[model samples]
Target: MTAIAVTIAGTDPTAGAGIQADLKTFSALGVYGATVMTALVAQNTTGVQGVHDVPAEFVRAQMRSVFTDLDVDAVKIGMLSRPETIRAVADGLAEFAARNIVLDPVMVAQSGDPLITPEAVATLRDTLLPMAMVITPNLPEAARLLDADPAGDEHAMLEQGRRLLDLGPEAVVIKGGHGTGAESVDLLVTQDEVVRLAAERIATRNTHGTGCTLSSAIAAGLATGAPLASAVRAAKDYLTAALAAADDLRIGHGQGPVHHFHALWPNLPGEKR
Candidate 1:
């Protein structure tokens, strides 16, 4: 059977994040992609200018429409800008009995603009956290979700991951991209063990939709029947290569997106393919 993954996320006009990025990641990983949009965001790689949210009931309707027809193998959930939107997604997931849910708790944009409200964040942490198979949160996002200080070191990151694991996800991946280090590290924490995945930090300002891409890649892997750890490892490797090749494309003034098609694109003159 063909692997299918659905992305329930917002819209990014620049196609760097949200549903657009999710679909790109899914296709890059050879998974069939579907989407449910929660918001129409007027933004780009520079920053988010404005957001118009889809009604909660409409969000539910979209989910129902997709879930009924598609035998979705995995789901990658991204931005839910409002509290009601979060609730609606949670309810719909239960209604359909979705599996292999990869939750990326997106709170802020790459430009430092806030994408979700405090109330919505609380709702996501409370209502949706427990339903996720794996939750991926960067340093600041983990701190915000826990209502605690950001984790500074490996020990602190593990402690925070453990706390998040208690909230119901089978595993938690704490991304270390925001931290000051020569090599970026991400810790995958489960009840059984903690696996550290690291890569040489690429020196580029273009990493607009990294979290969205990683989560969607994981969903693609899961849709293909890979184990959680294997999925995560593969996703990390893909993202690292994409980041390394980000400068190959000039998308916008601010942080450009990672090269989602880096591996497939032909190696052109003076460009890293």
Candidate 2:
């Protein structure tokens, strides 16, 4: 049986983030990738120049087309630029009763561009968050979602994760990679338990699209029948290795991208300079 995962995100022409990165990550992890673009971004490793969000009706149409034709084992959502689009997506998921929905509440980009608006955040919390199977948010994003300052420590991260759980997702993964530290710790909190995944932070500039890749990988695992915790664990391991492997590949003049195919063709992991 083949596993399929859908990514609802913006399009990055550079292929470093958004739907392109999600698709590449899904393929590398052996899952069929499908996508519906919410916006078109003119961006690169360095920064984003502009964004053009797709109309809400068109977004709904694309989602309907996909769900109508495909089994859609799982869905990963990212970069929804407008509140209407977010509401539509939430409604569509409810209409289709799609399972294994992974929501990556993408508030800002690595380059510090605003991918989501203030109004859209409310929509995510009130509309989409309830329907998500799991929601993945980094420290900054979690803070924004919770409308509270992340205490800049593990304790705060845990609290914020728990707060997000109140919004209705089955689980919340508070990514700690964005925190200032030598170790990256991601806290996964569910109704049952809190699972922590920690890894030594790799000093690499090639970390673009990491969030998209990780969420999509988790979606892939879920689509293939892996339990939520197990799926997140697998995704963390894969992403850690991918980061280590591509720490040196210079894809662009600015911060480069993690080599998604590094596992397919193993070479030296990370740059020793």
Candidate 3:
């Protein structure tokens, strides 16, 4: 049987993030990928220029079309920019009783551009967080979800991870890429156990789709029937490798994208996606 993974996200023409990055990650991990677009973004490596949202009804229609025919193993959600879109996804997931939903609370872009509306934040917390099997949030996003300042230390990061778990996710992983350190550390907090995953920080400017790539990679793992801890560990490893290989294909001038096909094409020339 083919493992299937679906991504609900916005579009980035640069193919560095959002649906494009997600689908690429799924394929690279050997999972069949599907998509439902919530918004169309006009942007590049530098910053976001504009956004055009899809109707909530249409988004739901896309979900129904995919779920009805395919036995989706995992669903990866990103960039729900409106309250209506968030509600639509929540309702659709409920209909499917989605078990392996991985929620990436994507707020701002790597270029520091906001991708979601202020109204969607509360809706996302109250409506979608409970349905997620795992939620991946960076420090600032975690703070926004909890309505607190960004966690300044590791202790605070773990504490906030616990707090996010209280909101109903089975697990929460706090990504440490934004923090200052020689090694990047990620905290995976759950009701049963908390695992701290750390890796040597790779110095690279090609970090445009880091969050999207990691979350989608986790979804791919889950689609392959891997346990949550194992999935996260593997995803982190994949992200580190992708980041290291990011310079292999310098797509844009500002920030480059991770080489999702690095393992297969080790010496790929820098080509525009």
In order, candidate lDDTs are 0.95, 0.89, 0.94
lDDT of 1: 0.95
| Per-residue lDDT of candidate 2, residues 167-221 (tens digit) | 9999999999988888999999998999999998988988889999899989999
By lDDT, the best candidate is 1
lDDT of 1 by residue, 226-254 (tens): 99999999999999999998999889888
By TM-score, who's the top model here? 1
Weakest lDDT window of 10 consecutive positions for candidate 1 = 264-273
lDDT of 2 at 266: 43
lDDT of 3 by residue, 80-156 (tens): 99999999999999998877999999999999999999999999999999999999999999999999999988899
Tell how far residue 215 is off in model 3, in angstroms: 0.4
Ranking by TM-score: 1, 3, 2
lDDT of 2 at 179: 86
TM-score of candidate 1 against the unseen true structure: 0.98
TM-score of each: 0.98, 0.96, 0.97
